[model samples]
Target: MENCELLEKCVFFNDKMGNMPSTASVIKMRYCREDSSGCARYLVCKALGRENVPADLFPNQEDRARQLIASAR
Candidate 1:
């Protein structure tokens, strides 16, 4: 899959698991972008995919990602 797709999937999985890594965590890991968009999530997901993490392992990843993004105040 493309990097963007992988990142999205990773964010979905992570958020679903209730372990949403903070923006600081992402920044410390150098995954966050200056752009205030979903780009950070995408980057993190792509990184996870590079490590061979399977998105299918989390059945509700997409839904969870959507919910997390929506619920973010």
Candidate 2:
């Protein structure tokens, strides 16, 4: 699958995951590179906007992402 369009600007990698290269790479492979639809940050960004996606939000936090989307609606 194609990489996520928001990969370059994703705070998860640029900031949160900056200190953990190995872990970040693994997550990137699973979410940013392989598939982004399941990424919580991506979900919020798509449903609302990049601004609405919390800086602390991680790719795997799908449940929280759903709640955020719901609250916004």
Among all candidates shown, the one with the greatest TM-score: 2
Query: For model 1, which pairs clash?
Result: 7-45, 7-46
**Listing every candidate in turn, what is its Cα RMSD in Å to the true structure after a full C-alpha superposition?**
13.6, 1.1
User: What tens-digit string does per-residue lDDT give for candidate 2 at 1-73?
Assistant: 9889998988886778778889888988999999899999999999999999998888999999999999989
Model 1, 1-73: lDDT tens digits are 1233343435443454345557435542332223323443443244443444334333223455445445542
Q: For candidate 2, give the lDDT.
A: 0.91
TM-score, each model? 0.23, 0.90
- lDDT against the true structure, per candidate, is 0.39, 0.91
- Candidate 2 residue spans exceeding 4 A from truth: none
After superposition on all CA atoms, how large is the RMSD of candidate 2? 1.1
Give the per-residue Cα lDDT of candidate 2 at 60: 93
